[model samples]
Target: MGAVLAKSSSFLFILAAGYLLKRFGVFGKKDYAVLSKVVLNLTLPAAVITNFAAMEWSAQLLLIPVLAFLLNWLMMGVGLLASRRQAAPTRALFVLNCPGYNIGAFALPFVQSFLGPQAVVGACLFDVGNAIMCTGGSYAFTSAWLRAGGQRLSVRDAARRLFSSVPFDTYLAMLVLVVAGVAIPQGAVDFISPIAAANPFVAMLMVGMMFEVDLKPGYLRQMGLVLALRLGSAVLLAVAMYQLLPFSLPIRQVLAVMVFAPASVIAPAFTVKCGGDAGLAGCLNSLTILAGILGMLCTILVLGVA
Candidate 1:
């Protein structure tokens, strides 16, 4: 119990420290980009490599990403249904904001902190499909939803979006190696272990620096609806996975917390691209971050994993 508390607390402290440091001008508003580069290009990919390399391959492991991919589409459908009577822009907002988890930056570290490296395999695999959706899969779907079918991506474009992410690319590589029954050399894993170990700290701090909270009157309605749908879906996902799935306790717990992850960090940008209001998207995205914190804590406590 003490060890779990300490681990969670330390990660939370680093997160708060990043926000404070940015507020105090220790890091410029945009300096989170540097941290972003390090995380996506370095520490995160290293962690992905280490975790996936360590994961014993199974046909069942492939289902994790499939579930993640399907979940995004499910939310997209829900978003459309909820806003069916509204304007196109509003519908676009609902669809874009409703799905997409901030796994790499927000949820991964939580799984790592409480569950450890082997458990991270589930999260990493989940991210594979998640990265696809968050990066451009949702965008394509939203564009189609808005009758901007002309803007729909080619297969090449979709491939480009997925391949463009360093950590995501590493996920594919590792999955390939594992599926092929090729063992990653012990020396290679050892070499990247130190870099992988930095992931939780770097990722938590990066999220803090990137965190924004700017709520306004007009945002209230949209933000509330988006959050309600998001959290509501999270409950269904958690219950379904926790009670029905055959996963071990740690992986199940990780998935429960993960389903509550905040809106994707890029959701606002995608919102604008879809002709939705960036302000509303940004506000909802920000609030979800706070909600994500609360949701994870509650899930951990309720499951008696703490």
Candidate 2:
């Protein structure tokens, strides 16, 4: 128990350092945009390639992506339901709020530490699934909403837009790396290792940057409904699935705990780029991430792992 708390504290501290750096104006707005591009286009993809390239493919692994989509969709449903009785901003918050673990940086290493090497493969699968759902599913949802508001996107145009996105490219590169059996040079691997290693720090720092934006107090009160539904649903579903699924205890527990992880930090940014509400998305994203960290710790304790 002390060991787990030690590791968790170390993660939060690094996260706090990033936030403090952002808070003190060590980086300007342009710097964040620059950082975002570099990390999304180069560092993250490289990390995914290095990780996925080493994993052996399996049908069971495919289940991870499918499950990820279902979970996101389920969360989306919760958001939509919440919005039906609320205002538009609130609705946007709910929909944008629904996502599973932040793969690659935040969840991967933590998972690897507890579950060993095999969990890296699960991370890869989860990443692929998340990319598809966040990219493809988000586009579809936005298209519908925009068209209802008198803006329509043709099938070709939507596909072209999605293809041009970085997440799509990252997913494609990871797939190619996994299928082709190519080996990255050790020097190149060394170059990327630090970037990948710095992932969680990047995530927490982004949260701090959002904090600097000075959101309304009422906005947070409004978010309380969403926080409960989204986080609670994830934890409850994870527990139920872990117990009922026909799998080994380890896999069940890991999957359950991971589900409780915060929504992917990148999703709100993606939502903004894809023409969704970036600020509202950021609000939900921040709160969920804060909750996810707590929920995941609880999940780990429940699983009886030290």
Candidate 3:
């Protein structure tokens, strides 16, 4: 328990450090965009490749994507129902904010630290579906919902968006190598290993830099409702998985942690694209990160794993 607490504290401390640095003008908000690109295009992809390369392939692992997709759709339904009475743009933001999880940047570090390589692989595989939702599913849903007449999204366009994600592309490449019994050259692995190691710190720092809170009229109430519905669904799902699933401990643990992952950072951008309030979305995203950290810490303690 002490170890888990220490680990959680260390992660939070780094996050605080980043926030403080930004507050002090050591790094400006503009710098965060550069840093985000670094994490997304470079460090994150390297980390995905490194971890996936090290994993043992299994046919049973196919379940991860299926589970991930189902969970996201379920939450999308919750979000849509929760905001059905809102105006179109606000409704789009509410629904957009609910489904995607910040698995790669937020959940990966904890899973890697507390679980093992197998769990890392499980988390990464689950992220395959998540990346799809983050990049394309949310946008498509919002567009259809907000259109005067509901419209279907182009499947090809969505696929193009999904395939263009660097981390997702890396996942595909690594999976191919794993299935073909190909090994990454030790020299190349050595090159990537250090960059991969930077993922957790860079990711946490990005979250801290992006953190903000807003207390405008009715904003708190809306944020509270969205969070309540999201977290409530997570609790029910966690209970069901624990009591009913036939999976092993590690798989259950990975899913449990993932259930509480923060809203995707791309959410605010998507909200803006849908003509919603980006500031409110950003605030909600930040708060979810804060809440997710606490929720995951509790989850770890309850599971009695460090």
Candidate 4:
């Protein structure tokens, strides 16, 4: 427990550093934009490939894709229904933020600590499907919502729009490399390991920077409701899956608790790219991170990893 908290604190510290860097203009917005692109496209995909390569898949791992999609869809439904009485922008944030969980970095570290190296393999399998959903699902939802709101639409433009925004294709390419049994040269893995280590740190720093932005308190107020819904839904789903799913109890517990993890740190960037409100999205993203810390702690206390 002490170790988990220490690691989590390290993550938050890196996030704070990113915030300070941005605020001081040490890394200009243009620099952040470029750095983010490199991390998402190049570093992230390499990390995914390396991690997934470490796994030995089974029928269970194959179901992970479907489960990830369903979990996101279900949570999106909860967000949409909850925010129906609110405005489009609010709903957009709600839907866009639903599929988020920094499973690769946040949950994986803790799971590895509690459940051992094997948990790392399970998490990579889970994250592959998650990466696909993040790329495809977020694109489809954001593009469709924007179009319906009288925003301009073009299939080619949308395709290009989606491709340019995130690292899904890169992640997919890495997954293909692993699935096809291609060796990732030793030099490449060593090179990217530092970047992979930096992923969460970079995200946290970006969050701290976002905290410096000025916004109405009313807009920030809704974050409480958002946190409640997100955590509640995850806990409920975890309990249900544990009791009902045919998978091993350990896997069910891991997935359920993971659902309670924070909104993906990358969500604000995605929302901003899609012409959504970046600041509001950032606010929600921060609140979820704070709230998720509690949820994850609770899950760990109760479940005590296999």
lDDT of each: 0.84, 0.63, 0.81, 0.64
lDDT of 2 by residue, 21-136 (tens): 77677866445566556556665566565555445654465677677777787777777776686544445556756654576545654665555435556656666666555544
Which candidate's TM-score is highest?
1
lDDT of 3 by residue, 35-153 (tens): 78888898888877777767777777777888888888888888888888778877877788889999888898778777777778888888998888888787787777675223455
Candidate 2 residue-wise lDDT at 290: 74
Ranking by lDDT: 1, 3, 4, 2
For residue 152, give model 3's deviation from the true position in Å: 8.6
1-306 per-residue lDDT for model 4 (tens digits): 676567667766776787778778787754555655655665555556556555554455567657876788777787778878766666767777876677754565455445543345555556655755465466467657643243444556545644664445554565566567777787877777776555555544544554444456866666667777887888788788767877765567677677877787667766665566767777788677667767876786677552
TM-score of 2: 0.78
Candidate numbers sorted by TM-score from highest down:
1, 3, 2, 4
Best by lDDT: 1
TM-score of each: 0.94, 0.78, 0.92, 0.74
Q: Write the per-residue lDDT of candidate 1 for residues 18-43, one digit (tens) a residue.
A: 99999999999999999999999999
* TM-score of predicted structure 3: 0.92
Off by over 4 Å in 4: 21-31, 102-118, 131-133, 136-139, 142-167, 177-215, 241-254, 264-278
